[model samples]
Target: MADNNNTLRTGDVVMYKNQYRATVSEVNADAGTVKITFDTGGASTVPVSDVKKA
Candidate 1:
């Protein structure tokens, strides 16, 4: 995460590829990575640059 102050918590919905909605499960600002559990039941680690708050 470029901005650590802008923290996202679990259950926060975000937009990913294909307009899919995912919840923030974990965040690693140092690595600019966030672990998201998608509405489709899939979890993945995505770079902060690839996501946007929904």
Candidate 2:
């Protein structure tokens, strides 16, 4: 399996389920999670598996 840390980072634009586009605001390698800030001014932290590079 690909490691989350190796796949994502802050400032990276990415895609998620439901066709949402988000920008990476933070990365927590220790937790295998990333914080994404959406275009709508909302933010969410999700597992790396839930996101992909846009």
Each candidate structure's count of clashing pairs: 1, 0
lDDT of 2 at 1: 43
- Cα lDDT tens digits for candidate 1, 1-54: 344645676667888774888988988878878899998998999987666778
Which candidate number has the best lDDT?
2
- Give the Cα-based TM-score of candidate 2 against the true structure: 0.82
Off by over 4 Å in 2: 1-6
lDDT of 2 at 12: 94
CA displacement after TM-score superposition, residue 22 of candidate 2 (Å): 0.3
lDDT of 1: 0.79
Q: Which stretch of 10 consecutive residues in model 2 shows the poorest summed lDDT?
A: 1-10
Q: What TM-score would each prediction reach against the true structure?
A: 0.77, 0.82
Off by over 4 Å in 1: 1-6
* Colliding residue pairs in candidate 2: none
